[model samples]
Target: MQTVVQAAAWAQTLGLPRLEAQVLLLHALGRAPHDRAWLLAHSDDALDTAVQATFATNTQRRLNTEPVAYITGQKEFFGLTLHVDHRVLDPRADTETLVEWALSCLADTPSPEVVDLGTGSGAIALALKHSRPDAQVCAVDASADALSVASANAKRLALPVDFHHGSWLAPLNGCTFDAIVSNPPYVASDDAHLAALKHEPLSALASGVDGLDDIRTIVRQAAQHLKPNGWLLLEHGYDQSHAVQTLLGNQGFVNVQSRPDLAGILRCTGGQWPTVK
Candidate 1:
Protein backbone atom coordinates (compact mmCIF):
# COMPACT_ATOMS: atom_id res chain seq x y z
CA MET A 1 0.00 0.00 0.00
CA GLN A 2 1.21 3.44 -0.86
CA THR A 3 -0.12 6.95 -0.81
CA VAL A 4 -1.16 8.77 -4.02
CA VAL A 5 1.69 11.18 -3.53
CA GLN A 6 4.11 8.28 -3.18
CA ALA A 7 2.85 6.51 -6.29
CA ALA A 8 3.01 9.74 -8.26
CA ALA A 9 6.53 10.31 -7.06
CA TRP A 10 7.47 6.75 -8.06
CA ALA A 11 6.07 7.27 -11.57
CA GLN A 12 7.94 10.52 -11.94
CA THR A 13 11.15 8.81 -10.82
CA LEU A 14 10.51 6.30 -13.63
CA GLY A 15 10.97 9.16 -16.13
CA LEU A 16 7.30 9.56 -17.08
CA PRO A 17 6.07 13.05 -17.86
CA ARG A 18 4.14 14.67 -15.01
CA LEU A 19 0.70 14.22 -16.58
CA GLU A 20 1.34 10.69 -17.77
CA ALA A 21 2.65 9.72 -14.35
CA GLN A 22 -0.44 11.07 -12.61
CA VAL A 23 -2.82 9.44 -15.06
CA LEU A 24 -1.06 6.07 -14.79
CA LEU A 25 -1.10 6.25 -11.04
CA LEU A 26 -4.80 7.02 -11.06
CA HIS A 27 -5.46 4.07 -13.35
CA ALA A 28 -3.26 1.68 -11.42
CA LEU A 29 -4.95 2.47 -8.12
CA GLY A 30 -8.43 1.76 -9.54
CA ARG A 31 -9.52 4.76 -7.58
CA ALA A 32 -10.41 8.31 -8.36
CA PRO A 33 -8.67 11.16 -6.61
CA HIS A 34 -11.14 10.99 -3.73
CA ASP A 35 -10.49 7.27 -3.19
CA ARG A 36 -6.74 7.65 -3.12
CA ALA A 37 -6.36 6.82 0.55
CA TRP A 38 -8.51 3.70 0.31
CA LEU A 39 -6.52 2.44 -2.65
CA LEU A 40 -3.19 3.20 -0.99
CA ALA A 41 -4.11 1.36 2.21
CA HIS A 42 -5.05 -1.80 0.26
CA SER A 43 -2.33 -1.71 -2.41
CA ASP A 44 -0.11 -4.81 -2.77
CA ASP A 45 2.61 -6.31 -4.92
CA ALA A 46 0.04 -7.01 -7.67
CA LEU A 47 -0.73 -3.30 -7.75
CA ASP A 48 2.92 -2.51 -8.12
CA THR A 49 3.24 -4.98 -10.99
CA ALA A 50 0.24 -3.47 -12.71
CA VAL A 51 1.61 0.05 -12.34
CA GLN A 52 5.03 -0.97 -13.63
CA ALA A 53 3.46 -2.77 -16.58
CA THR A 54 1.46 0.31 -17.50
CA PHE A 55 4.50 2.51 -17.17
CA ALA A 56 6.62 0.26 -19.34
CA THR A 57 3.93 -0.06 -22.01
CA ASN A 58 3.29 3.68 -22.17
CA THR A 59 6.94 4.64 -22.13
CA GLN A 60 7.93 2.20 -24.84
CA ARG A 61 4.98 3.06 -27.07
CA ARG A 62 5.63 6.75 -26.66
CA LEU A 63 9.24 6.21 -27.54
CA ASN A 64 8.09 4.42 -30.67
CA THR A 65 5.69 7.29 -31.51
CA GLU A 66 2.56 5.29 -30.70
CA PRO A 67 -0.28 7.56 -29.62
CA VAL A 68 -1.07 7.65 -25.94
CA ALA A 69 -4.65 6.70 -26.68
CA TYR A 70 -3.45 3.53 -28.35
CA ILE A 71 -1.21 2.84 -25.41
CA THR A 72 -3.85 3.59 -22.79
CA GLY A 73 -6.71 2.00 -24.75
CA GLN A 74 -8.98 4.97 -24.16
CA LYS A 75 -9.70 8.55 -25.15
CA GLU A 76 -12.19 11.21 -24.12
CA PHE A 77 -14.40 12.92 -26.66
CA PHE A 78 -17.52 15.03 -26.38
CA GLY A 79 -17.20 14.80 -22.58
CA LEU A 80 -17.52 11.02 -22.74
CA THR A 81 -14.76 8.54 -22.10
CA LEU A 82 -14.38 6.01 -24.94
CA HIS A 83 -12.46 2.74 -25.17
CA VAL A 84 -9.90 2.80 -27.93
CA ASP A 85 -7.08 0.64 -29.32
CA HIS A 86 -5.16 -0.02 -32.51
CA ARG A 87 -8.37 -1.31 -34.06
CA VAL A 88 -9.85 2.20 -34.14
CA LEU A 89 -8.68 5.73 -34.62
CA ASP A 90 -8.24 7.71 -31.42
CA PRO A 91 -10.99 10.29 -30.95
CA ARG A 92 -9.56 13.78 -30.86
CA ALA A 93 -11.01 16.77 -29.02
CA ASP A 94 -11.02 18.68 -32.26
CA THR A 95 -13.67 16.32 -33.54
CA GLU A 96 -16.00 17.59 -30.81
CA THR A 97 -16.47 20.69 -32.93
CA LEU A 98 -18.35 18.57 -35.42
CA VAL A 99 -20.55 17.10 -32.67
CA GLU A 100 -21.37 20.56 -31.31
CA TRP A 101 -22.24 21.77 -34.79
CA ALA A 102 -24.40 18.73 -35.41
CA LEU A 103 -26.26 19.27 -32.16
CA SER A 104 -27.02 22.83 -33.15
CA CYS A 105 -28.22 21.79 -36.59
CA LEU A 106 -30.55 19.19 -35.14
CA ALA A 107 -31.87 21.42 -32.34
CA ASP A 108 -35.13 22.17 -34.11
CA THR A 109 -35.57 18.89 -35.89
CA PRO A 110 -37.73 16.46 -34.03
CA SER A 111 -36.08 13.06 -33.59
CA PRO A 112 -33.44 13.80 -36.16
CA GLU A 113 -31.82 10.82 -37.83
CA VAL A 114 -28.06 11.16 -37.87
CA VAL A 115 -25.46 8.95 -39.52
CA ASP A 116 -21.80 8.96 -38.60
CA LEU A 117 -19.49 7.69 -41.31
CA GLY A 118 -16.26 6.04 -40.24
CA THR A 119 -17.43 5.76 -36.66
CA GLY A 120 -14.24 4.66 -35.04
CA SER A 121 -14.72 3.80 -31.34
CA GLY A 122 -18.30 5.04 -31.89
CA ALA A 123 -17.31 8.41 -30.48
CA ILE A 124 -19.47 10.65 -32.64
CA ALA A 125 -22.53 8.46 -32.95
CA LEU A 126 -22.53 7.37 -29.33
CA ALA A 127 -21.99 10.88 -28.03
CA LEU A 128 -24.80 12.22 -30.17
CA LYS A 129 -27.14 9.42 -29.08
CA HIS A 130 -26.24 9.99 -25.46
CA SER A 131 -27.16 13.66 -25.73
CA ARG A 132 -30.32 13.13 -27.77
CA PRO A 133 -31.91 9.93 -26.68
CA ASP A 134 -34.80 10.41 -29.06
CA ALA A 135 -32.58 10.75 -32.10
CA GLN A 136 -32.09 7.78 -34.40
CA VAL A 137 -28.34 7.51 -34.73
CA CYS A 138 -26.48 5.01 -36.90
CA ALA A 139 -22.76 4.61 -37.47
CA VAL A 140 -20.82 2.86 -40.23
CA ASP A 141 -17.22 1.78 -40.42
CA ALA A 142 -15.29 -0.20 -42.99
CA SER A 143 -13.42 -2.18 -40.41
CA ALA A 144 -15.31 -4.85 -38.54
CA ASP A 145 -12.67 -4.76 -35.83
CA ALA A 146 -13.33 -1.08 -35.34
CA LEU A 147 -17.06 -1.71 -35.27
CA SER A 148 -16.60 -4.33 -32.57
CA VAL A 149 -14.79 -1.83 -30.39
CA ALA A 150 -17.50 0.73 -31.16
CA SER A 151 -20.25 -1.72 -30.28
CA ALA A 152 -18.64 -2.43 -26.93
CA ASN A 153 -18.43 1.28 -26.23
CA ALA A 154 -22.05 1.86 -27.19
CA LYS A 155 -23.14 -0.91 -24.86
CA ARG A 156 -20.92 0.36 -22.09
CA LEU A 157 -22.40 3.82 -22.41
CA ALA A 158 -25.94 2.45 -22.78
CA LEU A 159 -26.36 4.52 -25.92
CA PRO A 160 -28.52 2.79 -28.46
CA VAL A 161 -26.89 3.36 -31.83
CA ASP A 162 -27.11 1.16 -34.88
CA PHE A 163 -23.63 -0.05 -35.80
CA HIS A 164 -22.95 -1.31 -39.31
CA HIS A 165 -19.76 -2.83 -40.64
CA GLY A 166 -19.24 -1.57 -44.14
CA SER A 167 -17.44 1.06 -46.08
CA TRP A 168 -18.88 4.59 -46.25
CA LEU A 169 -22.54 4.41 -47.24
CA ALA A 170 -22.72 0.79 -48.34
CA PRO A 171 -24.51 -0.26 -45.19
CA LEU A 172 -26.92 2.67 -45.43
CA ASN A 173 -28.33 1.83 -48.79
CA GLY A 174 -31.69 3.57 -49.37
CA CYS A 175 -31.40 5.05 -45.88
CA THR A 176 -31.80 8.80 -45.50
CA PHE A 177 -30.87 11.03 -42.63
CA ASP A 178 -31.43 14.58 -41.48
CA ALA A 179 -27.70 14.91 -40.91
CA ILE A 180 -24.54 13.07 -41.92
CA VAL A 181 -21.23 13.69 -40.19
CA SER A 182 -17.80 12.17 -40.52
CA ASN A 183 -14.22 12.59 -39.38
CA PRO A 184 -12.83 10.76 -42.32
CA PRO A 185 -9.31 9.91 -43.51
CA TYR A 186 -8.12 13.18 -44.97
CA VAL A 187 -4.39 12.89 -44.58
CA ALA A 188 -2.39 12.86 -47.77
CA SER A 189 -0.31 9.77 -48.30
CA ASP A 190 2.89 11.74 -48.61
CA ASP A 191 2.28 14.10 -45.74
CA ALA A 192 4.97 14.22 -43.13
CA HIS A 193 2.38 13.37 -40.51
CA LEU A 194 2.20 9.87 -41.94
CA ALA A 195 5.62 9.18 -40.48
CA ALA A 196 4.19 9.59 -37.04
CA LEU A 197 0.83 8.12 -38.04
CA LYS A 198 2.32 4.79 -39.01
CA HIS A 199 1.29 3.49 -35.64
CA GLU A 200 -2.35 3.93 -36.68
CA PRO A 201 -4.06 1.80 -39.25
CA LEU A 202 -3.27 3.17 -42.68
CA SER A 203 -6.89 2.84 -43.78
CA ALA A 204 -7.97 4.95 -40.84
CA LEU A 205 -5.69 7.89 -41.52
CA ALA A 206 -4.37 8.33 -45.05
CA SER A 207 -6.56 8.78 -48.09
CA GLY A 208 -5.14 9.51 -51.52
CA VAL A 209 -2.19 11.49 -52.75
CA ASP A 210 -4.04 14.76 -52.18
CA GLY A 211 -5.65 13.64 -48.89
CA LEU A 212 -9.05 14.67 -50.31
CA ASP A 213 -9.87 11.26 -51.71
CA ASP A 214 -12.17 10.14 -48.93
CA ILE A 215 -13.53 13.66 -48.54
CA ARG A 216 -14.32 13.76 -52.22
CA THR A 217 -16.03 10.41 -52.08
CA ILE A 218 -18.08 11.34 -49.06
CA VAL A 219 -19.14 14.64 -50.60
CA ARG A 220 -20.05 12.97 -53.84
CA GLN A 221 -22.21 10.29 -52.26
CA ALA A 222 -23.63 12.09 -49.24
CA ALA A 223 -26.25 13.91 -51.31
CA GLN A 224 -27.91 10.63 -52.20
CA HIS A 225 -28.42 9.77 -48.55
CA LEU A 226 -29.39 13.16 -47.15
CA LYS A 227 -32.93 14.37 -46.82
CA PRO A 228 -33.80 17.65 -48.50
CA ASN A 229 -32.04 20.52 -46.71
CA GLY A 230 -30.09 17.99 -44.67
CA TRP A 231 -26.74 18.92 -43.21
CA LEU A 232 -23.41 17.27 -44.00
CA LEU A 233 -20.48 18.07 -41.76
CA LEU A 234 -16.91 16.80 -41.89
CA GLU A 235 -13.71 17.25 -39.93
CA HIS A 236 -10.65 17.58 -42.10
CA GLY A 237 -7.01 18.51 -42.03
CA TYR A 238 -6.37 22.13 -41.17
CA ASP A 239 -5.29 23.04 -44.68
CA GLN A 240 -8.16 21.35 -46.53
CA SER A 241 -10.99 23.73 -45.71
CA HIS A 242 -10.94 25.68 -48.99
CA ALA A 243 -10.80 22.53 -51.04
CA VAL A 244 -13.55 20.95 -49.01
CA GLN A 245 -15.74 24.03 -49.35
CA THR A 246 -15.24 23.96 -53.09
CA LEU A 247 -16.12 20.31 -53.19
CA LEU A 248 -19.28 20.92 -51.23
CA GLY A 249 -20.24 23.87 -53.41
CA ASN A 250 -19.67 21.92 -56.57
CA GLN A 251 -21.93 19.22 -55.19
CA GLY A 252 -24.74 21.82 -54.94
CA PHE A 253 -24.50 22.28 -51.21
CA VAL A 254 -25.57 25.70 -49.98
CA ASN A 255 -24.19 27.82 -47.15
CA VAL A 256 -20.89 25.98 -47.33
CA GLN A 257 -18.63 27.15 -44.53
CA SER A 258 -15.60 26.21 -42.48
CA ARG A 259 -15.36 26.58 -38.72
CA PRO A 260 -12.17 27.19 -36.81
CA ASP A 261 -11.13 24.87 -34.01
CA LEU A 262 -9.74 25.99 -30.67
CA ALA A 263 -6.44 26.55 -32.40
CA GLY A 264 -8.16 28.75 -34.98
CA ILE A 265 -7.45 26.24 -37.72
CA LEU A 266 -10.24 25.75 -40.23
CA ARG A 267 -10.76 22.14 -39.22
CA CYS A 268 -14.42 21.49 -39.89
CA THR A 269 -16.42 22.17 -43.03
CA GLY A 270 -20.16 21.82 -43.50
CA GLY A 271 -23.06 22.67 -45.75
CA GLN A 272 -26.72 21.99 -46.33
CA TRP A 273 -28.09 19.88 -49.14
CA PRO A 274 -30.11 22.12 -51.39
CA THR A 275 -33.84 22.22 -50.78
CA VAL A 276 -35.84 20.64 -53.53
CA LYS A 277 -36.34 23.25 -56.26
Candidate 2:
Protein backbone atom coordinates (compact mmCIF):
# COMPACT_ATOMS: atom_id res chain seq x y z
CA MET A 1 0.00 0.00 0.00
CA GLN A 2 1.24 3.46 -0.90
CA THR A 3 1.67 6.01 1.84
CA VAL A 4 0.08 9.46 1.57
CA VAL A 5 3.34 11.00 0.42
CA GLN A 6 4.03 8.07 -1.84
CA ALA A 7 0.68 8.43 -3.60
CA ALA A 8 1.31 12.12 -4.18
CA ALA A 9 4.81 11.38 -5.44
CA TRP A 10 3.50 8.66 -7.74
CA ALA A 11 0.96 11.02 -9.34
CA GLN A 12 3.65 13.64 -9.92
CA THR A 13 5.64 10.94 -11.72
CA LEU A 14 2.80 10.82 -14.21
CA GLY A 15 3.39 14.53 -15.09
CA LEU A 16 0.80 16.13 -12.80
CA PRO A 17 1.77 19.37 -11.11
CA ARG A 18 2.67 19.04 -7.43
CA LEU A 19 -0.36 21.07 -6.37
CA GLU A 20 -2.74 19.05 -8.56
CA ALA A 21 -1.31 15.76 -7.29
CA GLN A 22 -1.65 16.86 -3.68
CA VAL A 23 -5.24 18.07 -4.16
CA LEU A 24 -6.26 14.83 -5.89
CA LEU A 25 -4.64 12.73 -3.20
CA LEU A 26 -6.29 14.76 -0.47
CA HIS A 27 -9.59 14.38 -2.24
CA ALA A 28 -9.13 10.62 -2.46
CA LEU A 29 -8.28 10.52 1.22
CA GLY A 30 -11.50 12.39 2.04
CA ARG A 31 -9.58 15.39 3.33
CA ALA A 32 -9.98 19.06 2.56
CA PRO A 33 -8.12 20.07 -0.57
CA HIS A 34 -6.50 22.92 1.32
CA ASP A 35 -5.29 20.59 4.08
CA ARG A 36 -1.75 20.31 2.78
CA ALA A 37 -0.28 20.60 6.24
CA TRP A 38 -2.12 17.43 7.19
CA LEU A 39 -0.47 15.68 4.30
CA LEU A 40 2.95 16.69 5.58
CA ALA A 41 2.12 15.63 9.12
CA HIS A 42 0.81 12.28 7.90
CA SER A 43 3.15 11.98 4.95
CA ASP A 44 4.14 8.47 5.87
CA ASP A 45 0.68 7.26 6.81
CA ALA A 46 -0.32 4.31 4.66
CA LEU A 47 -3.26 4.85 2.42
CA ASP A 48 -6.09 2.33 2.34
CA THR A 49 -6.04 0.17 -0.79
CA ALA A 50 -9.27 1.80 -2.00
CA VAL A 51 -7.85 5.26 -1.43
CA GLN A 52 -4.78 4.47 -3.53
CA ALA A 53 -6.98 3.34 -6.39
CA THR A 54 -9.08 6.44 -6.17
CA PHE A 55 -5.98 8.60 -6.22
CA ALA A 56 -4.73 6.89 -9.35
CA THR A 57 -8.08 7.43 -11.07
CA ASN A 58 -8.11 11.10 -10.19
CA THR A 59 -4.56 11.44 -11.44
CA GLN A 60 -5.61 10.18 -14.85
CA ARG A 61 -8.47 12.64 -14.93
CA ARG A 62 -5.97 15.44 -14.44
CA LEU A 63 -3.84 14.01 -17.20
CA ASN A 64 -6.86 14.24 -19.45
CA THR A 65 -7.01 18.01 -18.82
CA GLU A 66 -9.98 17.83 -16.46
CA PRO A 67 -10.02 20.74 -14.00
CA VAL A 68 -8.99 19.90 -10.46
CA ALA A 69 -12.00 21.79 -9.10
CA TYR A 70 -14.35 19.63 -11.14
CA ILE A 71 -12.70 16.42 -9.92
CA THR A 72 -12.80 17.66 -6.33
CA GLY A 73 -16.32 19.09 -6.89
CA GLN A 74 -15.50 22.42 -5.30
CA LYS A 75 -13.49 25.60 -5.84
CA GLU A 76 -12.58 28.57 -3.69
CA PHE A 77 -13.51 31.90 -5.28
CA PHE A 78 -13.44 35.34 -3.68
CA GLY A 79 -12.98 33.84 -0.22
CA LEU A 80 -15.94 31.49 -0.66
CA THR A 81 -15.92 27.72 -1.07
CA LEU A 82 -18.20 26.94 -4.02
CA HIS A 83 -19.40 23.52 -5.13
CA VAL A 84 -18.83 23.04 -8.83
CA ASP A 85 -19.24 20.42 -11.56
CA HIS A 86 -19.18 20.06 -15.33
CA ARG A 87 -22.70 21.45 -15.49
CA VAL A 88 -21.20 24.93 -15.03
CA LEU A 89 -18.01 26.63 -16.07
CA ASP A 90 -15.38 26.44 -13.36
CA PRO A 91 -15.04 29.87 -11.74
CA ARG A 92 -11.68 31.52 -12.37
CA ALA A 93 -9.78 33.65 -9.91
CA ASP A 94 -9.37 36.32 -12.53
CA THR A 95 -13.11 36.85 -12.63
CA GLU A 96 -12.75 38.20 -9.14
CA THR A 97 -11.46 41.37 -10.79
CA LEU A 98 -14.92 42.01 -12.11
CA VAL A 99 -16.47 41.34 -8.72
CA GLU A 100 -14.06 43.71 -7.00
CA TRP A 101 -14.82 46.36 -9.58
CA ALA A 102 -18.54 45.94 -9.06
CA LEU A 103 -18.16 46.21 -5.30
CA SER A 104 -16.13 49.40 -5.65
CA CYS A 105 -18.81 50.86 -7.89
CA LEU A 106 -21.53 50.08 -5.36
CA ALA A 107 -19.54 51.03 -2.27
CA ASP A 108 -21.11 54.47 -1.92
CA THR A 109 -24.65 53.37 -2.65
CA PRO A 110 -26.60 52.05 0.32
CA SER A 111 -28.43 48.78 -0.33
CA PRO A 112 -27.53 48.91 -4.01
CA GLU A 113 -29.36 46.76 -6.52
CA VAL A 114 -27.04 44.52 -8.54
CA VAL A 115 -27.40 41.74 -11.10
CA ASP A 116 -24.90 39.21 -12.39
CA LEU A 117 -25.66 38.05 -15.89
CA GLY A 118 -24.32 34.65 -17.04
CA THR A 119 -23.70 33.68 -13.45
CA GLY A 120 -22.40 30.17 -14.13
CA SER A 121 -21.79 29.14 -10.51
CA GLY A 122 -23.27 32.31 -8.96
CA ALA A 123 -19.74 33.26 -7.97
CA ILE A 124 -20.04 36.94 -8.86
CA ALA A 125 -23.50 37.43 -7.40
CA LEU A 126 -22.71 35.44 -4.28
CA ALA A 127 -19.44 37.23 -3.70
CA LEU A 128 -21.13 40.60 -4.03
CA LYS A 129 -23.85 39.61 -1.58
CA HIS A 130 -21.32 38.22 0.88
CA SER A 131 -19.28 41.41 0.76
CA ARG A 132 -22.19 43.81 0.91
CA PRO A 133 -25.00 42.06 2.77
CA ASP A 134 -27.17 45.15 2.47
CA ALA A 135 -27.03 44.95 -1.32
CA GLN A 136 -29.85 43.32 -3.26
CA VAL A 137 -28.10 40.90 -5.66
CA CYS A 138 -29.75 38.98 -8.48
CA ALA A 139 -28.22 36.44 -10.90
CA VAL A 140 -29.31 35.24 -14.34
CA ASP A 141 -28.23 32.32 -16.53
CA ALA A 142 -29.38 31.01 -19.89
CA SER A 143 -28.99 27.36 -18.98
CA ALA A 144 -31.32 25.74 -16.47
CA ASP A 145 -28.57 23.32 -15.52
CA ALA A 146 -26.24 26.23 -14.85
CA LEU A 147 -28.91 27.85 -12.71
CA SER A 148 -29.24 24.65 -10.68
CA VAL A 149 -25.54 24.64 -9.88
CA ALA A 150 -25.49 28.40 -9.11
CA SER A 151 -28.56 28.22 -6.89
CA ALA A 152 -27.16 25.27 -4.96
CA ASN A 153 -24.03 27.32 -4.20
CA ALA A 154 -26.21 30.18 -3.02
CA LYS A 155 -28.27 27.87 -0.79
CA ARG A 156 -25.19 26.20 0.65
CA LEU A 157 -23.47 29.50 1.34
CA ALA A 158 -26.69 30.90 2.85
CA LEU A 159 -26.43 33.92 0.55
CA PRO A 160 -29.91 34.95 -0.51
CA VAL A 161 -29.09 36.00 -4.09
CA ASP A 162 -32.15 36.08 -6.28
CA PHE A 163 -31.70 33.81 -9.34
CA HIS A 164 -33.49 33.98 -12.67
CA HIS A 165 -33.38 31.70 -15.71
CA GLY A 166 -33.19 33.48 -19.04
CA SER A 167 -30.82 35.02 -21.53
CA TRP A 168 -28.87 38.07 -20.42
CA LEU A 169 -31.03 40.93 -19.15
CA ALA A 170 -34.22 39.35 -20.45
CA PRO A 171 -35.83 37.89 -17.35
CA LEU A 172 -35.89 41.13 -15.36
CA ASN A 173 -37.66 43.38 -17.77
CA GLY A 174 -38.82 46.71 -16.28
CA CYS A 175 -36.38 46.18 -13.41
CA THR A 176 -33.34 48.39 -13.13
CA PHE A 177 -30.20 47.68 -11.15
CA ASP A 178 -27.52 49.92 -9.69
CA ALA A 179 -24.94 47.70 -11.39
CA ILE A 180 -24.85 44.80 -13.86
CA VAL A 181 -21.86 42.49 -14.17
CA SER A 182 -21.15 39.51 -16.38
CA ASN A 183 -18.37 37.14 -17.51
CA PRO A 184 -19.92 35.94 -20.69
CA PRO A 185 -18.41 33.57 -23.28
CA TYR A 186 -15.89 35.56 -25.30
CA VAL A 187 -13.89 32.84 -27.02
CA ALA A 188 -14.14 32.66 -30.78
CA SER A 189 -15.93 29.52 -31.91
CA ASP A 190 -12.93 28.59 -34.03
CA ASP A 191 -10.29 29.37 -31.44
CA ALA A 192 -7.85 26.52 -30.81
CA HIS A 193 -8.17 27.07 -27.08
CA LEU A 194 -11.51 25.30 -27.21
CA ALA A 195 -9.61 22.04 -27.56
CA ALA A 196 -8.03 22.51 -24.15
CA LEU A 197 -11.39 23.46 -22.64
CA LYS A 198 -13.39 20.59 -24.06
CA HIS A 199 -14.21 19.44 -20.55
CA GLU A 200 -16.16 22.68 -19.91
CA PRO A 201 -19.61 23.43 -21.29
CA LEU A 202 -19.16 24.66 -24.88
CA SER A 203 -21.99 27.16 -24.62
CA ALA A 204 -20.23 28.79 -21.70
CA LEU A 205 -16.87 29.11 -23.50
CA ALA A 206 -17.50 30.33 -27.03
CA SER A 207 -19.43 33.14 -28.68
CA GLY A 208 -19.68 34.07 -32.36
CA VAL A 209 -16.92 34.48 -34.93
CA ASP A 210 -15.24 37.38 -33.16
CA GLY A 211 -16.39 36.10 -29.78
CA LEU A 212 -18.14 39.41 -29.02
CA ASP A 213 -21.69 38.32 -29.73
CA ASP A 214 -22.68 37.99 -26.11
CA ILE A 215 -20.79 41.14 -25.14
CA ARG A 216 -22.60 43.05 -27.85
CA THR A 217 -25.93 41.75 -26.72
CA ILE A 218 -25.29 42.66 -23.09
CA VAL A 219 -24.01 46.17 -23.89
CA ARG A 220 -27.06 46.76 -26.06
CA GLN A 221 -29.51 45.53 -23.44
CA ALA A 222 -27.78 46.79 -20.30
CA ALA A 223 -28.61 50.46 -20.93
CA GLN A 224 -32.29 49.73 -20.57
CA HIS A 225 -31.87 47.79 -17.32
CA LEU A 226 -29.40 50.03 -15.54
CA LYS A 227 -30.33 52.92 -13.28
CA PRO A 228 -28.89 56.30 -14.15
CA ASN A 229 -25.24 56.48 -13.02
CA GLY A 230 -25.23 52.66 -12.74
CA TRP A 231 -22.30 50.56 -13.92
CA LEU A 232 -21.91 47.66 -16.33
CA LEU A 233 -18.80 45.54 -15.75
CA LEU A 234 -17.62 42.57 -17.80
CA GLU A 235 -14.81 40.06 -17.69
CA HIS A 236 -13.66 39.43 -21.22
CA GLY A 237 -10.88 37.95 -23.32
CA TYR A 238 -7.37 39.20 -22.76
CA ASP A 239 -7.18 41.32 -25.93
CA GLN A 240 -10.76 42.54 -26.21
CA SER A 241 -10.62 45.55 -23.91
CA HIS A 242 -10.52 48.13 -26.67
CA ALA A 243 -13.41 46.54 -28.51
CA VAL A 244 -15.42 46.27 -25.30
CA GLN A 245 -14.66 49.87 -24.36
CA THR A 246 -15.76 50.99 -27.83
CA LEU A 247 -19.00 49.08 -27.51
CA LEU A 248 -19.78 50.66 -24.17
CA GLY A 249 -18.94 54.10 -25.54
CA ASN A 250 -21.20 53.61 -28.56
CA GLN A 251 -23.95 52.61 -26.15
CA GLY A 252 -23.48 56.08 -24.58
CA PHE A 253 -21.95 54.66 -21.42
CA VAL A 254 -19.64 57.09 -19.64
CA ASN A 255 -16.38 56.56 -17.77
CA VAL A 256 -15.44 53.52 -19.89
CA GLN A 257 -12.26 51.83 -18.79
CA SER A 258 -10.60 48.46 -18.11
CA ARG A 259 -9.14 46.89 -14.98
CA PRO A 260 -6.21 44.51 -14.84
CA ASP A 261 -6.45 41.11 -13.29
CA LEU A 262 -3.97 39.84 -10.71
CA ALA A 263 -1.47 39.20 -13.50
CA GLY A 264 -1.84 42.77 -14.77
CA ILE A 265 -3.75 41.78 -17.86
CA LEU A 266 -6.69 43.96 -18.78
CA ARG A 267 -9.23 41.23 -18.17
CA CYS A 268 -12.27 43.30 -17.17
CA THR A 269 -13.87 46.40 -18.64
CA GLY A 270 -16.75 48.62 -17.56
CA GLY A 271 -18.51 51.98 -17.92
CA GLN A 272 -21.16 53.97 -16.15
CA TRP A 273 -24.58 54.88 -17.56
CA PRO A 274 -24.92 58.66 -17.69
CA THR A 275 -26.82 60.17 -14.77
CA VAL A 276 -28.17 62.83 -17.14
CA LYS A 277 -30.30 62.13 -20.22
What pairs collide in candidate 2?
none
TM-score of predicted model 1? 0.88
Candidate 2 lDDT (Cα, 0 to 1): 0.94
lDDT for each candidate structure: 0.85, 0.94
Give the least accurate 10-residue stretch of model 2, judged by summed lDDT. Answer: 1-10
| Model 2 lDDT tens row, 7-55 | 8888888899999999998899899989999999999999999999898
lDDT of 1 by residue, 167-271 (tens): 898888999999999999999999897886667888998999999999999999998999998999999998999999999999999989998888999999999
Each candidate's clash count? 0, 0
Q: How displaced is residue 5 in candidate 2, in Å?
A: 1.6
